[model samples]
Target chain A: MSVTSTTSQPNYHILSVLVQNRSGVLARVAGLFARRGYNIFSLAVAPTEDDALSRITIVVDVESTPLEQIVKQLFKLIEVVKISELDPRRSVERELLLATVRATCDDRGQVVELANIFEGKILAVGADAITVSLDGHPDKLDDFEELLRGYGIVELQRTGRVALPKLDREARLRAVKGKVV
Target chain B: MKMTGAQALIKALEMEGTEVMFGLPGGCILPAYDPLLDSSIRHILVRHEQGAGHMAEGYAHVTGRPGVAMVTSGPAATNMVTPLCDAYMDSIPMVCITGQVPTSAIGTDAFQECDTVGITRSVTKHNELVMSAQDLPLAIRQAFHIATTGRPGPTLIDIPKDVLQNSMEWHWPTDAEVIDSLPGYRPTMKGHPRMIKEAARLILESERPILYVGGGVLKARAAEALLELAELTNIHVVTTLMARGAFPDSHPLCLGMPGMHGTASAITAMQQSDLLVALGARFDDRITGKVSSFAQQAKIIHVDIDPAEQGKVRRPDVPIVGDCRLVIEEIVKAIRELLATGSTQADTSVWKSRISGWREQFPLSYEPSEPGEALKPQFCLEALRDSAPPDTILVSGVGQHQMWSSQYWRFDKPYTWVNSGGLGTMGFSVPAAIGAKVGRPEATVWAIDGDGCFQMTAQELVTASTERIPVKVAILNNSYLGMVRQWQEMFYEERYSEVYLSPDTPDFVKWAEAMGCVGIRVDSPEEVQPAIDRANSIDDRPVVVDFRVAASEKVFPMVPAGFGNDDLLLPPSQMARKEFLR
Candidate 1:
């Protein structure tokens, strides 16, 4: 809910929304934001563990619309069950980057080595191009993509950011130590 | 019992105690109309789909029940969009059942097909497309529940033709089951204890507190509780236009409607107050013209069932999301408990006197009747207001007549005065008056409409006559669209534009006679009362009284949209619009 916590361009909110799995629900949710003139930076919808529900991860720019207005408007949708904002400081966010980069037999090692450094997988290689898929934090992917630009970027795709709250310190410590409650 | 979806729809309506519904039949909805033949519920066939929707709204307003309307897809459903928006804006609980194209034919762009649910999504609180016959009962149950609960508004259920024709085993869902299915929808019905105490404390301690009541109070049926709370604090009450009759106008503490066209006293009282206890009212732009400067001295305590409305406009110092009646009842109890412990009430006597002084100095008045001049619209309204029974229900369409009706009428009861406040829907009165009369049969209902507004839905009088609903209509005829003319004269430098509607084009008298009702035309001030009395005396059919009034008179004291309430242009001063607009 607090977009001011993290200093970034175009103050944003990553809302993790749980919605009733019903026909046209996505349209309803998306239509509301469009109708209200709120900009949706990126949206990713997938079925949740519950077959009757779906989780929609929406990265929305809070530039013109108030964060509460977004939350309240979304809640007005009957299909929407809950909305919780994922704080950048307390959550983990990552995107998948699939790119086809220009690489010849002469400089294929440097391309492979750079991919190796980012723990990216080499999907396919041709006479003049190498395909790679990298999954990491959006910032990390940004840095990796910047380096790949030198190899002459051909085609690229980034799955919009998906996030979940990171386990608290106590829970993490307890899990590492295997402590009983 | 195995029954067709159409039969189940009827059975569900009966289960919800819907005695009557307004509708217009069409191809897709034909199957449902057949079931109505065997059902106990009476269907009032309307001339237009919009009339049916407004009738349902009017019915809901007086009866505290979800008014039901049925219509078919495509044009018929499209025709209902206005009423849906109107009901949505006013928070009227209504259920509109639309017959959609069959599920198999839905995406094919079949004949007479439109996405009813999709088109009406924003206007309705909730809407559903019943794809299966089995979901009909539950869809209806949920529709009523959603429409009547929380901050009530219109809800819709679009049933496909095939679905209605399909058969399913009937099973009525209990309230718990309905609640269980909708996991996300839970309205806060009561205020938190701590918040209630704090609100009571503020009410008791503030020296200049005013109760800014709104339509939500009437929606909640919280008028009694509101009256109790207001009396307990001895606070002055200013009902918003949406809340005209929510507080008794006869009460000494009541300051008429507050906002753009509100009374000078109400406007000033709100402007100067230290504490504003806004109950069931959003700080709508109309009420808060130039909102930043509106009631700058007041710390607002807002109570509403809708959370989104809490800080939508003016941020409340104490925001309590709950039913107005429950919240106000609790606040009253909390205040009493505090008072029992030796807490004293704030001294609002000086504030009260100042308000009284303003009320006296700038009382709602108009140009007096000249010997031969056209009858004043305000004079006609006062005649109707004064002659009507104390409990008679008054309805008005939006325009100069509507503003005059609000300004002049002495409404001392809740639900007795109904209008399209939020939507400002012209032509609402003609059909809404019919619905209100139907809902409250014994009470005399009147539609105070403008010449422009009356022309829009006057055809509904044929439906009223056929149904034998005796509602009276008063057309404050001013040749021109009076409100539009006034605005043009004041703001647009008197360029008359396309506002003038030739008065004699379709004679309202002949129009009423053709519709099988009594029509009376009054052109002078003296004829106002006699015409109203004559109209009231007739109980056989609807009565339309057209009072030709002067178009030059405009509503005042005017805040002139986008200006602060503090800058009211009380007439004679209205001629000095340049000074205020500057």
Candidate 2:
């Protein structure tokens, strides 16, 4: 199944805001989202090779009409360099991980069997326990892990959402603070 | 020829075959930068000295070569600390060149000077401050040699500003002998062959024999030999976190990574096995659940390139050191002799069945609900993996994702998965992905970063779009510093103070677009895969998928540091079941 952008407007336009590196920069940016009642799907800060700048990737549901207004207000922050709407139409990637699973005695065999099928691993074991680890596309893992639900699952550790784009010359970083390297 | 210290430094680095140097220009290093203009080495000017240090680490990892970084003294040198410590923890080969105050002014606290030597002594494998211009060439040569050799780690050379501009005749020491004065540096290869033979005999005789592998395999570039041994012995293999992907994950006998987060079957297998051949793995606490219970029934054969690692933790029945590749080759020859003579024991089905029994006993599980109000990080990871190319190189920042990626990423090829495994460096992924993308332009690279860690070096995203490096970054953003928060929750009574991430939408989509990049935001579980697919659709221009995930989520099956693997903390769901089901 492919991700097809639908005519029905996306509930939220995924936005990544590039801002200057400064203390409380996240607070100011997050403040804007909070004021607008935009629930951030996920937010993280990463450094641009330029130390003075940091990129904040935020996933949130927003109505189609006022999205631009949100972008403009984000630019109002002194630390914000620019704002970009990530169109899934282009290239990107995401991933998460699961720690070991401890299946109940009765369900252990089937759980282990399912883990092998999903390319997951058995990390630890006790007289009556086991932990399995797996990483992949979330949906595929979800499908595989669903089979193991019958077995006792010890715990789940997940990374919050983090992402980046594909490469193209037009989008090549031209300058940092308008200064070319 | 007599030349300025800056010119000599450039010439020395050039001779060392350094193609790129990451650094930010500043006062003390100004003179050095002036000479850099005429050098052929490609200098990347970072915005901050810290980025340069980390970029050096990133470069070293991708290229499998020592990376060089230059900075001025004081804060510049201090700013480089995180990356230096990062390199030290990961055992990466890096050479840091920091400009110190004038040699005579060292203790005076001269303008823009700090105790570079004192500050870096603990973090670096070795630190030297060149007091004489005549020693510049020799120092550079030795630094490169030392950084890349024997348990590779970061090394630093603090050159005073006066030394950088000093004029002296350069007599490059063409051949500097290995220093013998260094303590515990010797790597021995001439171990008893009889012992190796005995080890092989143990392997053949034991009904349950397993190979415990580590990153030393990669460090030794012994993939071929490892594959050969695994195939010949028909032994199952388990890797440590640092040893992830040492053997192709697709190998049926491969048990994946083992430790606190390790698979139950692998741990049980190790416990039940009669013989365990430890390759390059140091038996860190993470892997050896409880030292006393670890491999309780097994006799271990520890093979490594470092002699010190032999008895550092669990003493080996057979300790072979020198080169992992060479030792493995020798072991193969001895084992072959045993088989040729038909003197060894036969198949190990009993042991395999025992391991199978353990595997059958415990298994990993996850919920299948489509992302809605609560978006699971696993959903995001699976989506990213499904959407990326088969050969994509996955890198990760340290924390839950780092462990999760090791467990979930399913890396079948060598070098496809890169992480700060030994060091667990938080800000490793983004810069490392950039370097990986740069080194292997045709390969797809993704950084599986945590929200807290992504923030640590998020600025590297600018490097991605600016350098036109196509590296996909999928952030598993549980707003809290998930790993630390887990520690607090489990051990510290969940007194979550600084752990909670204040919620907010930073408009990342508009930011990427503004930076002339692409961004995708997926809040619902249903949109996760679609967003990943859409992001992968574009071959050019970087994209970001910000998954709005649940907070208060803890990484499960954690064996808190210092605790044995058996001390694993079961998730709330499991705990709930135990309380309710009975």
Task: Give me the TM-scores of chain B across the candidates.
Answer: 0.98, 0.92
lDDT of 2 by residue, B42-146 (tens): 887665677787778767766777888999889999999888888876677899999888878878978998977666765776667888777788788878877
Instruction: Please provide, for model 1 over B1-582, each residue's C-alpha lDDT reduced to its tens digit, 9 standing for 90 to 100.
Output: 999999999999999999999999888888899989998999999999999999999999988899999999999999999999999999999999999988889988999998888899888899999899999999999999999999899999999999999999999999999998998898889888888899999999999999999999998899999999988888999999889889999999899998998988888889889999999999998898998889999999999999999898988999998999999999999999999999999888888787877776677889887899999888888888888976899999999899899999999999998899888898999999999999999999999998899989999999999999999999988898889999999999999999999979789999999999999999987787789889989999999998999989989878889999777778784444323221
Instruction: RMSD for all candidates, in order, please.
Output: 2.9, 28.8
Model 2 ranges off by over 4 Å? A1-181, B176-186, B189-192, B360-363, B492-495, B505-507, B510-517, B537-541, B560-563, B567-582
How displaced is residue B82 in candidate 2, in Å? 1.9
Q: CA shift at B98, candidate 2, in angstroms?
A: 1.1
Pick by lDDT: which candidate is best?
Answer: 1
Task: Output the worst ten-in-a-row residue range by lDDT, candidate 2 chain A.
Answer: A1-10
TM-score of chain B, candidate 1?
Answer: 0.98
In the order shown, the candidates' DockQ scores are 0.68, 0.01
Off by over 4 Å in 1: A1-10, A102-111, A126-130, A149-155, A173-181, B573-582
Cα deviation at B309, candidate 1, in Å, is 0.7
- CAPRI grade of model 2: incorrect
